[model samples]
Target chain A: MKKIMNAPDAFVAESLEGLVRAHEGLVTFGAGRTFIRRRDLAPGKVAVISGGGAGHEPLHSGFVGRGMLDAACTGHVFTSPTPDQIVAAMDETDTGAGCLLVVKNYDGDVMNFEMAAEMAASRHAIDTVIVEDDAATGPSLRSRGRRGIAGTVVVEKILGAAAEQGSNLAALKTLGDDLNRRIRSMGVALRGTTVPENARETFSLGPDEMEIGVGIHGEPGLERTRFAGANEIIRLLGERILAEFPSDVAEGGTARPLLIVNGFGGTPPIELYLAQGIAHRFFENHGVVPARTLTGTFVTSLDMAGLSITLALLDEVQFKLWCAPVATPCLSW
Target chain B: MKKIMNAPDAFVAESLEGLVRAHEGLVTFGAGRTFIRRRDLAPGKVAVISGGGAGHEPLHSGFVGRGMLDAACTGHVFTSPTPDQIVAAMDETDTGAGCLLVVKNYDGDVMNFEMAAEMAASRHAIDTVIVEDDAATGPSLRSRGRRGIAGTVVVEKILGAAAEQGSNLAALKTLGDDLNRRIRSMGVALRGTTVPENARETFSLGPDEMEIGVGIHGEPGLERTRFAGANEIIRLLGERILAEFPSDVAEGGTARPLLIVNGFGGTPPIELYLAQGIAHRFFENHGVVPARTLTGTFVTSLDMAGLSITLALLDEVQFKLWCAPVATPCLSW
Candidate 1:
């Protein structure tokens, strides 16, 4: 693969080191560089921690700072972080209130973070919330349930704000579960990503083909279809996500949705914005009024040329929390 | 050829429309949607305007808001904005304090922006400053001088703050010129971008080759060398940029440079951060200390798979101005 990397094996560690160095004022590395935490942690506030593979950047790590995640445990590309790393993140960021672990719905990630929570329970109050907002997989087919995709960003943001506001561990856990139930995401990949160590693309497709409902780890998408226009692609993804919305959120009553049109790494901002325009129209035609819209590359699948649309049904309090200010390297408002 | 776009010809306009829609609170479109201006413009502050081809996103358009460019005119992908678009931007953003036009050094860009300045002069005071900080092309070889690349972002940030602080048209122009002279940039491309209209890659390279000193518009670099490690590649680009620094700035006596490691769309954050770490070490070995560093995809060449490094030699005044707070959609620091 043609990539700017010193050594394939050193990709994850070096990238984390660079992240710390680049945002020196905002974050620092824990002992052994297993985890990164904000420089200044508010005393007696619940610490929010989340992490997974290194490829989907600006996810767990980039969201670490004052208004978002307290710490993020990083792992190798498309690989889950070790339980020890997650434990270190928990230990480093725990102030006194407790720690909240935001784990995505991958088997490896769920197990690892759960193991870390069990390991750290004696020392501090620890809770793990599994985010299964990916609506790509059918509910009954997979034992692991829905895979977590870009909706993790929405979970982290709202939960981070709630944690910062002195919410207890139980309260944060409830909020996370509620938010995950309300959020739905689906992605379409135009190309697969090349892992640093592989030196080749993980998967291949025909020139005129595109993968719909693709997972973030370069997993096979639900369907491989001929490439279509931007609006058509967005409509398929949007309809799938909208159809999966909880009954209460799906009804066009008083619910206002927060839309996230996320690019999978390689897509440029122009395309993301174009997708957002199409998404706005899509929602409008469906008789839904989106309250807040976020369009950018928040979560990515390392150099994958694709985009995902996430719709999070927000209540008044949730909308306020979503609108709350955040100060992180990748996200600042 | 895989991309998320509707019609190739409608790409630029549709993208701009999405930008205005996404950041409706911060910006609005002109009468013909040729230009976008800040929603709230200070009555007496000098207006800062910049524009060029559409492919290099977040460069001229994303920087339009509170403390950055008052307006930005956009053109078709890799094509210069027409004089009419530039004139519309100038006319819409001009206040009693006059307007400052920041143009990158390109034959078409310079000619068109200059013509727009002439056309807008009768209605309001207008001044133009050309940015030519690309050190890849020698001064004597190209009639238009060094091509402007990522340094244009630096010029916009520094001058945007100065303009917001009530700097007049002449002062802003001088500051832009000084900042432009102090900045130097060079890039490398692993792959070329595919413009929507073309529906194919702009250029092609061998499997194990990379282009050094590549232009933002997918132009061939100064050399096509075998691919190397990240450190080696960064070292080469850094050395070339450092060697061409003005003697005064090169002395490194109390000069705190601002470093920008920009991605050309397709490069992921992991690779960009890895390159940043290597850049830091290269600067340390060369006895140069970068006071501030901004790393992300600030300037991009559509979906090109490569990156560019820009080092702006900043003095105390410029550094302070850089630190000043500004609220824009893409940049809010």
Candidate 2:
């Protein structure tokens, strides 16, 4: 587990500098930190901002651009960004129109971003949208508040596109709520990732085993499962997400859904695509038309060797917003 | 190594199906994979087409979309697409504006794409641009031509953006040639990635050691060296690339270049970003200003545990084009 970092502590700061240097045209920031807001922020448009730990490359920060998030706060690898940093990003990207804080369902993310959002709301008219789409871990009741996973990208993109299209703060919140109703995600990890500065594995998983319902922080999944083929894996995960679909979409069967085949960390695009093939066939066989799809590393769990699937059931307007141009690093469609 | 795949042979076809299904609005293909092109190809733009082995996730196909590649020919994992498939892509995407083929410097990629281009040239007046930017293996002038690595993205993006702006085939070739002169890439791998179906590692290095200047196919590199810190690694690779910079850009003591910190399959984005940080500091210390930077799994070697760096010396026009909008699945900036 050798790595090429200078020092464990300097890793985050140095990485941000490099990111800014590379994307100078689309990004700019205050001296001394990683919060780079989108270059062209309009005063009248509500801003969407999100961030978390640093390990998930292109997640919160890389997504800060047009038709996506307007600002991102980067924490240390696997650690939540401080509430102060989140507040800084909110302030930097905030125009008179207000801001939207999209927090993942993780305990750290929820607490930190919520605190920042509350702080912002006290100072300004900032809004918030919490995404909790993970369907893997649950007691299916009060404890079943879904953990945010790769599906956060779909939510952010939809909401961001709506925000870009002059959706007012109230309109944006309605769109965000609509996005929440239509989205569900689940993931499994075959292996754990090594933190570069640590020069060691973050968590341990049996080489021959995989865990379904895995979270991004290398959190233990609901259960350890035997390795299976792509089709079986998709069927197992899809069944859970499908069960969560709204009765109208499932019963009426008139609306089409957007599919997202998201790689966790180290899984190759080839494997993700294979999993996607299975998920697509299963969804199509269920008479649900997939109107739009995104396949790539949207939200990742460091280098966890697995993937997640997100199904965003869309209305006509949501479908149109989903197809809007996005200028993020990893996503553009 | 556990993988979520059905059969080794079925990986490519299944992945393609999943890709198109997921990106339903952006991509379309014929049955039996005869032709695959973006849904947004305009009326008379010069089609920019390129392809090789299937392992590179977004290279030939992930890049197919508006403002980027018009079409791409995909083959089996790490295998070149058949001539018939390449010819079909050319025919479908090529209008009277002609087409430009961007082939990597590998023997197989060059041979296969050249053959397809020749086949297309027999009927349509098509031009080709061969990129050879892996400076670690070149500079002897007599040795086998330089190996192409991550620099392919720069070339493809510039050519694709130029084509999107309605550049003719000849103009696109000129831009590609200029980029070839400016770009250089080198890769290091800690371990090799296994083929999906077989789960057999393609190339081998020691657990604690790394190979520099390796090709994408897990082929032997120009050197086998002990792993060092990111600064030292970037210094070594940067020195090699800087040696190849054109005198005009390198002369004014302002040789600002675009940086690409690429992951060779297994390397995580966290480690890649740390490495990019070190690489940036080293370049700045050496009197080089980095104009643009991208760090991710642009071209991969399955799940090989490694990273590659590409430095493309940027002129004014190149910098502007690099900052241009590129709407591709894997990369967008």
Best by lDDT: 1
lDDT for A20 in candidate 1 is: 81
TM-score of chain B of 1: 0.98
Per-residue lDDT of candidate 1, residues B201-272 (tens digit) = 778989799999999888878999999889889988999998887787787564778888899998888888
Enumerate residue pairs that collide in model 1.
A1-A199
Chain B TM-scores per candidate, in order, are 0.98, 0.94
Tell me candidate 2's fraction of native contacts, as a decimal between 0 and 1: 0.65
Share of true Cα-Cα contacts across chains kept by each model:
0.68, 0.65
lDDT of 2 by residue, B1-333 (tens): 677787777878787777776665677884357556878778789988888888887576777787778888887788778788888888887777888888887777778877887877877778888888887777474254787778888888888888888888888888898888888888887777787656678877776677877888888877888877677778778887788766765674554578789887666666677787778877788777676678777888877777888888877777777778876666665
Cα lDDT listed for each candidate: 0.87, 0.78
